[model samples]
Target: MPPNPDLRQTIDVAPGLDLAATLGPLRLGVSDPCWRVEASGPWWWATRTPAGPLTVHLVPGAGVVGVEAWGEGVEWLPRHLGRLLGLDADGPPAARTELVRALAQRVPGFRVAGHGRVADAAIDGICRRGVSAFEAARSWLLMVEAMGDDAPGPGGLRLPPAPRRVASCDPYELHVMGLEQGRADEVRRVASHASRLEAGTHDGGAEAIAHLAGIAGIGTDAVEHARAVALGDPDAVPVLDAHRTAAVVRALWTGAGADDTVDVRSLLEPHRPERGLLVRLIALVEAADAADDDGGLTP
Candidate 1:
């Protein structure tokens, strides 16, 4: 028999609180083992919490979102569910700026995703450092299947390797999953301090990012990426690599070389208080536009 949910909670929703838009950032790709979505239906998420593994199903409809979760970690999922559902996210205030005003038109009532498990997100973020999303997603899946446990319920899901498990990994093992030596060591370093990292997660983004940045191999960009993916924090500094920086510069500005040397943080300053959410929104729109241009999804 399929496992029954150990707990159930119905979260009230605001209009236009889209499941796809709110939770999209947590998913590395369509094949991400940590998540599952049915056609026009609820999505499943298998997560590794501090307590243990959890499987969650979210059903979205008018003025409400229903959540059901099971497994050893169900108890810990509730307090953090609000953070994950975009409910706790700061909404656009009066739309004073052009960016805010335009976002109001394009994706209304959108919420950024919050990853409740800081260490798990950090691990996945490490996998993503200096690589393509496809590579990151694939490496994450393989690493989980090879070292993690099966999640309860359906969708054949698996959680990311636990913090203790990651902490114990030999660099060569993670290397087999496509993590270079530096990232592999970084993974272990972060996982070794998993307790402290998780303890400080609630201390806010700056503190958490500062802690992560001090680690030998981890960069501020990766930490910010983890913060965005892990916390859905609106305050997170955006991760701007050369390619993404160029894309933003071209799409948003006219003259490039002279005026826009690097100074990404300065350019993005105006969007503060909502910078992380804004970056996610732009990516979502760009991805949709690309799909539409390519004849859209095929059956």
Candidate 2:
């Protein structure tokens, strides 16, 4: 049968943009339960909006990101397309320092993609706390598989459970999914207040972070990560892990050690609002180098 009719829209974008580089950070993995990316092709994302479940497929062409969506929230994706792709970001402010300039050159077209929903970002942030990226991704995939619903597409995808659904989950069940009791509780707390959190996505996320930080297990780092990923707060810097800290130190400060108490903000002062984007680019460059050294293996 021909593909079922679906609500769709195409958005023309600037030429030379790497859709993958712009959107890849949002995908947890190739087999991520919430999103799927066809190698060098389209990106499919599944989520539960306030209206209902939705699946959006993003395809990049000569100068556009084509969007095909299905389900009750089809219009929601297009409504926030600009924010999702960072179309409004005024590229990096003129790079002042040599380090910032070089780093910018290394990762061109790298945009900070936003989730457009504070609840989604908050849940991802909660899962990522005090864990390796691999572990965090695993927890996310497992939790979604256990709690999410089948997506409304041909890709055999799944939509993450609505916050209300997750909020109502039994802690013991979540514990079985490898979430410790504390983290599970944190997830529930955020989910229970998901509506309030969703409203906080506006105003650049200061309100969202403040609201979430009040909950146990959600800290400054988690709040920052959520703000950057969900609210598109250009200045939000994610809490870095040991390896990332070392990488930043080596890349920016020639002889600085990881324990040198480096003032990260000062290093990127010239790039104030774009600091988060700059940081992600540096991390991308580091990841690329490591991949090359490991014979193109990727984590």
For each candidate in the order shown, give its overall lDDT on alpha carbons.
0.73, 0.73
lDDT agreement of model 1 with the native? 0.73
The Cα error of candidate 1 at residue 25, in Å, is 0.7
Q: Encode model 1's per-residue lDDT on 1-299: one tens digit a residue.
A: 77778888788888668788778778777878889887876889997766777899999888888898888889778778877887776553345568756765576757866866666667777777777767777888888887788887765788777667878978888898899888888888988876656523466445665667777777666687778887777757544444555655554555545656656566667777766656666666666677788899621
Candidate 2 local lDDT, 1-299, one digit each (tens): 53663787788777666777777666554557887878777888888776677888888888788888888877566656776777756564355556667877776766666777777777777777777767777888888887788988776789875677789989997787668998899888888887777533356556766777787666676677787777667677765655666666666664544546886667666677667767777888887788899999975
Q: What is the TM-score of each candidate against the true structure?
A: 0.87, 0.86
Q: Candidate 1, after superposition: displacement of residue 140 in Å?
A: 1.3
